[model samples]
Target: MSKQKTQPSMIGRMLRHLAGTHAVARRAFPSATLKAIQAGIGEGEKQHRAQVRMIVETSLSLGAVWRGESSRQRAHELFSRYRIWDTEENCGVLVYVNLADHKVEIVADRGVSRVVTRQQWQDVCRAMTAGYAHGAYHESTLQALEQLHVLLAGAMPRDSGDTAGANELSDKPLIL
Candidate 1:
């Protein structure tokens, strides 16, 4: 057998791997969807003293891909980069989505993690992934936000007479 070049296949794979860029993320989560999610987060925080941020990235960086950095690793990096783990209450949670890999991860701070197990967060991510796979992008994300609200609300109830806690973090959805 003779060796053959497979540049086309390699290129195709690379292109697909970089499919989810900021533009793609915006399409998957338009302004309307982002607002809905943000509203949900704002409301969700009212019942609890936890901070939550949702970051959706279209694809992994070329460097990260070259290094075979899994979506989980990227998620953790984003979680820290956004300062989700630096909340005063230590109840920060990050719901990250990587469109290219169809990977979803929920990184919760110690305050929340103390009550919510790793499996619980994984389950939520799985549900979101399933939703994305089904092409129910907006619906799935909103639904996930609702579920997270319930969990956070129960685990970290707000202080007495506190209608809403400080907006420790922006209620905006991040796209990268």
Candidate 2:
């Protein structure tokens, strides 16, 4: 009687080595993509370095700078529709309504829960839900766009031979 012993085949050893090497390769990080992602985050931080007050005022002052009453009203209306409602205790709910696009986005600080009453958020959310529920987003956005156009028309400078036009180049009136 003879006892036979079977060792791992040469091909099996080679395949095992190849599998281990491939696993290491997959775990290796791509340095270029990582650098690009880091650079993008740094740029974003640089852009938002300004204080919160500065950002809020800048958004609010657009109306005054445009120098048009209707546009100003529209701006105010838009603000009234949505603003950073109460940031009590370093927390706030920011609301923005892009009526022209029939979209509403809200970002709230969960860290400061109960900062704003749930009722208010619900109301805005309900309106958005209604639009989505009815598939009326497009129609609402169109209406808002029309309103925005009307406001801009009032603000845009006219070429009606007025002092604002290019025809008024003379510093003094010439009696020619």
Candidate 3:
């Protein structure tokens, strides 16, 4: 009898989610890395008025996986839940990393979407994912942040003496 390779079953996805615990997330993003990411976000914000938030999730909930929630969908949910879209210029960006699904999603607010093309955002995600595939998590994140900063600076440069456009979102990177 010949054995055929098939797509991963729902049970298999659930098992993958169960294996991707908080411990795995912690291992991937330790305290020092998180601090660096936070600092990177702050530095990036200084170059532009846009708010950048990074979220690294080890896995989706069993229910989420069962419902076939995509990484992009989860990223949009987080973007909303965390109020990334509430920035002054409406140029907030969310970088979501799902380890279990091996996916990277970049969700940009409408203001940014107007200036930055989807292909540009996808390129950023692909670069980050490439670094992640090689276990260069910290380096990859910082590089992606730099790329985002450039994009935001081009799209919405911080105006001189515009104090009202101050930091509107948390600088801390969320690990879930």
Best by the lDDT measure:
3
Better of 2 and 3 by lDDT: 3
Question: How are the candidates ranked when ordered by lDDT, highest leading?
Answer: 3, 1, 2
Worst ten in a row by lDDT for model 3: 1-10
TM-score for each candidate, following the candidate numbering: 0.89, 0.21, 0.91
**Of 1 and 3, the candidate ranking higher by TM-score:** 3
Candidate number that wins on TM-score, 1 or 2: 1
lDDT of 3 by residue, 1-176 (tens): 12222235666778889999899888888999999999999988888878888889999998899888989999999999999999877888998999998899999899889988999888889888899999988899889888988988888888888655678788899988
* Model 1: ten consecutive residues of lowest lDDT: 1-10
- lDDT (C-alpha, whole model) for all candidates: 0.82, 0.31, 0.88
Q: Which lDDT tens digits does candidate 1 get at residues 1-176?
A: 12244555445546767665677777788889889998988888888888999888888767777676778899899888988888887888889888887789888888898888787777778778888998888998888788888877787888898885688888888888
| Candidate 2 vs. true structure, TM-score | 0.21
Order candidates by TM-score, high to low.
3, 1, 2
Candidate 1 residue pairs in clash (backbone atoms < 3 Å): 20-58
Q: Return the TM-score for candidate 3, rounded to 2 decimals.
A: 0.91
